[model samples]
Target: MSEFADQYLCAFRQTPAETELHQAAKRYVSEAEAYDRTVCTGPISKDGILPATPRELALVNRNAHALLTRIADAHSHLFSRGELLREISRVDRLGAPA
Candidate 1:
């Protein structure tokens, strides 16, 4: 697994949340993995770019947005801005953008 995946799994293990946030994170990870597999298997264009199909793009975007919103909603009220930034930094160290 990649560092990001390792970090995500670790986060899930370490943090406690309501069902919705947990599920959202799980879905985000699932969609990300799917995107990774798609990129690995997707066809390259004539110009050499690996363009995603509209459906694939939509799925990834939707899941990513949902995950971010869920994370924010789950933590925003509980954590101060500095605390949130620290958490975000930790997650960013996973080497993936949110």
Candidate 2:
């Protein structure tokens, strides 16, 4: 296993179970670790996000984007209106998201 995956897989151990973004984080971490495992276990990437193929990269992007959406939905209350708007625009989620 790459040390890259091991690092994040070990970092969020104390997140409360099934709450807010923790839910998506669970799935994201699982998928990331699985992807990391598919590669030859060798020198870990410095960026910790080296995908072996285009499809695998897409999967990672999708999961990460969804996780961020869940994070925004769960904590929108914590953000000021301008902050929320900026984030939404930054992620290109301004044009009718559900």
Candidate 3:
């Protein structure tokens, strides 16, 4: 989450906009999206191993919960910005908050 915030801030800093910690907010939402895309996708079958089963699904859910908790703690009000708001609209259009 902190890294997300840092990256968002960096992006804003690239421009001349004075984001004023709003970058942190954008970062949080971006992190959520990234996690959803990268980690939430079920694992692929490996070698002769099968894809993730129900047990693996449960574990993935648990780990995702923990990771989100940690991210929220680290980024507090990371979604308190216009950029994040726009992202919310974009994501909501796609479906859930993600």
Candidate 4:
């Protein structure tokens, strides 16, 4: 596993009880780590790239995006509107994302 994945495991300490959440978090971290690796490693097209099959990629992207938004919304007090706006701008810069 990647260091980021390991870090997540360490921080989250997943158990068999929350199997679904644990699996979802694992996928999100794994995908994020793959994205980071692809970007940082060299000249590679980050778009149209994914960890598993195209369908899996779509699922990962959809679920991860939804979970991230929920996390941000739930912890809105932890972030300012300006910061959130900047984040949205960053995502926009990435591409025409939803």
Candidate 5:
């Protein structure tokens, strides 16, 4: 497994009841890495412009998206309104609203 996949698996290991979520996360990471490799090795035209991505890459992306969505839905409770607002505020470097 790739380092990113291992990291995702480790994150999901926090919840023992989330065995399926862990597997889904691993699959998503694997698929995402495969897509990255495919894009990086894709053929280029004579003019140095990269050609269109293959259909396989699209399918890989869709699979990764589905797996990630399933994992997110299963863990949606972790992202409460307060937590989300805090995260947004942190990213925007602004204090939480009064």
Candidate 6:
């Protein structure tokens, strides 16, 4: 189970302009969509830059988890049960958290 994501940052309402999470989510979605549209859907290249190795991928995963954990810790009071449940469901679909 995703213990980290179960308590990851899902909301941020500090000052009147709490858009960090929203912007991060937007950027993530945009980049992912671009990856899908350009990388996955585009022509394949055998000699192009190869995908990240397992070790590299693991490093990235760990870094992301650490960053999210910090954000969640800093903004713990902003999170809600509903948001956390949604995060749990989302992370559960991915097998486990990093």
* Model 5 C-alpha lDDT per residue in residues 1-98, reported as the tens digit of each score: 99988776654234543343344444444455555555544555432223255765576557656655665676566543343334433533432233
Lowest lDDT sum, 10 consecutive residues, model 3, at 43-52
**Count of clashing pairs, candidate 2:** 0
Candidate 3 segments exceeding 4 Å error:
1-51, 80-98
Write down the RMSD of all candidates, one decimal each: 12.3, 16.2, 13.2, 14.8, 15.3, 13.8
**Any runs in candidate 2 off by more than 4 Å, and if so which?**
1-43, 80-98
Q: Which lDDT tens digits does candidate 6 get at residues 1-98?
A: 48887788467555522344343333333343344343332343532222345654455455545555555555557664344435544543443323
Q: Please report how far candidate 5 places residue 16 from its true position, in Å.
A: 12
Residue-by-residue lDDT tens digits, candidate 1, 1-98: 99988877653343453333344444445555556455543565432223367766676566656665666666665544344444444443453333
Q: Estimate each model's TM-score.
A: 0.37, 0.40, 0.34, 0.33, 0.33, 0.37
Q: Rank the candidates by lDDT, best first.
A: 1, 2, 4, 5, 3, 6
Which is the winner by lDDT between candidate 2 and candidate 5? 2
**What is the model-wide C-alpha lDDT for candidate 2?**
0.50
Candidate 5 TM-score over all chains jointly: 0.33
Q: Relative to the true structure, how large is the alpha-carbon lDDT of every model?
A: 0.51, 0.50, 0.46, 0.49, 0.48, 0.44
Model 6 residue 29 lDDT?
Answer: 35
Ranking by TM-score: 2, 1, 6, 3, 4, 5
Name the runs in model 1 displaced over 4 angstroms: 1-51, 80-90, 93-98
Which number leads on TM-score?
Answer: 2
Q: Report how far off residue 44 is in candidate 6 (Å).
A: 11
lDDT of 4 by residue, 33-86 (tens): 565454343333544344445555566566657756664465455554345445
